[model samples]
Target chain A: MTSIAVPPSAPEHTGSRLTRVLGAATAVSWVVWLTYGLVLSPADVVQSESVRLFYLHVPLALSAYLGFTVTLVGSILVLRKNSAFWDQMAGAGAEVGLVLAGLVLVTGALWGRPTWGTYWVWDPRITATTLLFLVYLGYLVVRRLDLDAEVRARRAAVFGIVAFINVPITRYSVQIWNSLHQEATLSLTDTEMDGSQLTSFALGAIAMALFTTWLIIHRFRVGWLEYELDRSGLESAILERRGERTATEVV
Target chain B: MIAAVAGDAARIVAKDLRIERATGVITTQILPFGIVMLLLFGFGVDPALQVRGGDRSVLAEVAPGLFWITVLLALLLVVGRAFAVESDDGSLDALLVAGVHPAAILGGKAVVVAAELVVLELVVGAGAVLMFDVTIGDPLHLVVVMVSTTVALAGAGTLFLAVVAGQRGRDTLGPLLVLPAMAPVLIGATAAAGDALYGAGSGGIAWTWALVAFALLYSVAGIVGAGALLEDV
Candidate 1:
């Protein structure tokens, strides 16, 4: 919030006017979509009002996958090209993806209470999503180790890319198992959803994705600055230590 | 580069096998914990030994599940050990500098983990069947379930191991990391064994076989992908 901290003329990507515009667009779209979904979207015939969960669950799940995909792609860059920028992207994306996955889990549980009459079931999709969340959490936590930057980044990058096993697992687990969860929105040889409901789902997913990409970019920039600060601090500390040793000898 | 990589791979695997053979120590660290878990499940949960109302069938159905739970936890135990072993001995850095393929490192570690799991599951499975009065209708489904689950678990676990090998808290974080990813194996094996114990009746083999294949496919995909992506890691 401080102009000094941001340093308007200090050779930094202080985010263009375009970013600000997109940010506002994202907020407006979210409000419109959430309100339309909550009040206007027609309820499912079988589950009545509870089916309104499709909005929260599907969008959140899609966003989580999108975020994780970014993490995966960023990690691939970290390993293939040894780019720290990609590492920062992976770290931030994992944390954000984990958050979205958590929302998906909570909303799914809430919906489960009405439809399945239980707060929890070992349903395939739910279980797989939970697993995916844990994997991302592991990736995030493991990166916190005090190791060389490349070492930490490369290790976590491998993890982000490898943990992608859960993507398909989450998408297909319900279909694979005798799950209590409903089938996917898009299925092979079958149409699972239609009309304004699908339209709403599509719009909400796009909005969430734009919002997610924006968050990831902002987070990556913050990480870059933080790394810069840390490197300078380390340099100063080392120089101060050398100065003190020389002073002691002079005394 | 490929041939050189293959040569190093062969050498590393050979060294690992010789070291393992000499020490005869593959996952001994997790053995104590695995034993405790099996005992707790047996004495605490199934102590009554009540076979009434087809509970025997249920226990038999759950037999394969016990091994998976054991495998997941035990794999968690050895993750820190696997990575810590390499780092403590400075072998990981040496290997990295030696131009050895990262896949070779993963494959070597995976072979050892697979061996440990196979041995661990055997002991644990025998103990469960003996203690719980469990039965099996077909030995082949049991084999498929065990092999597939073990492969899937070790593949997934070792992938995490490579990622977290340099970090702290790997000891506690390993199991936590392994479980959610291991869901398909748990459910698939449970369903397979449960169906077999309940009579292999109606939709049993088909569904169980399908899940096993799915687990295998995922595991192979995960292992190959991890091996490829973990190069600079």
Candidate 2:
């Protein structure tokens, strides 16, 4: 289990009762979501069967937004406090957000093909989302740079703050240009859902949110362990060198 | 405090301009690269091709976007060079140690870059007009869009340059860091320039305002954030 040099005090794995329970809830919710969303929900009047992708697509998009929000918040806190925990949180959120955003694009494209008669269009939302993805990808790239951990954290934090500020500007700019995307089906002041579709969507959202949380928790643990391993590795290397010198002196 | 920052910024700007004048890298290398890119774009667009339903050639129609794209590509190089000089000689560290505020350093560099980009735009805009036979219907609109876009690009580019200043593989990483952040500039500038050069409508004014807003947004971000960004660099 301890394939790398980790302190014995470190947790053996990135799981606990809470994650396991969340994992189980997520699995059950997904199962219910699939049964209802795929099999039971009536086909859309306009989209026909293709609308089924919404169950996954909308939830994934929301999760991606949530993940990035976490990143943005984490980044802010990191900058303010210079906390390692926030740095790790920022990193984990970006990774998960990137993955989910990728899926959101794919699903969106897939849904667009049959409904919009093309795989892609320069719709305002899609274009803005694509830019958002690229920005975060850049954020992750910065995080991966070979630098001191504190330096990297600071850089990433500054980037995260700036990138978040860019998001709304991007969205508004594209929106002002033109839009083929439909109005929001789910927003603070709106809900365009029927009973069955709403139920399935709510379930999917719960499932995805739980799953995203679980993944972030695990990812955060992994990042924490890596940090520990790096520090411990340096210490052990120094100790080994010191021991070798002492042995040679004795010899 | 504000006066001190402005004073330091002016000195840095003068220093950068002097270095630029002495070296002429922008005039010698970056300007030529922009023209060459314009030529390459002309070749790619094929001067013979015309828009399907319009009297104008395809090149004329796309000149605005192509012009801005060329500017953006050149911007990556300018930003990389701007920071490269600072990081190469440890001058950036020296500036910090000399008690120049980080915001002033960022502002000074951005001003030089913005000025250089203005020159690049004028030359490149002239090149596009001559090569593509494009006309400027609203010169005022065109100038507004260009200046705002340049300021925004320079501000964002300088901040992002500071982000990757001392990192390894910054050449590759710089574009990855800066370009996406500039997407709105690309969209707004292209659309606004298209309107300006084509007499499309009143929409050019709106887009210009958007560009101005973008400029203000990034300038504020650069001023407020450059200090924290460069703290550990």
The most accurate candidate by DockQ is 2
TM-score of 1: 0.82
Candidate 2 structure lDDT:
0.86
* Model 1 misplaced regions, further than 4 Å: A1-14, A42-46, A186-192, A232-251, B1-35, B46-49, B94-102, B192-233
TM-score for each prediction? 0.82, 0.92
Per-residue lDDT tens digits for candidate 1, residues A85-117, read 888888878878889999999998998898889
For each candidate, the DockQ is: 0.47, 0.68
lDDT of 1 at B24: 60
Top lDDT model: 2
Each candidate's chain B TM-score? 0.81, 0.96
- Considering just the first chain, candidate 1 attains a TM-score of 0.87
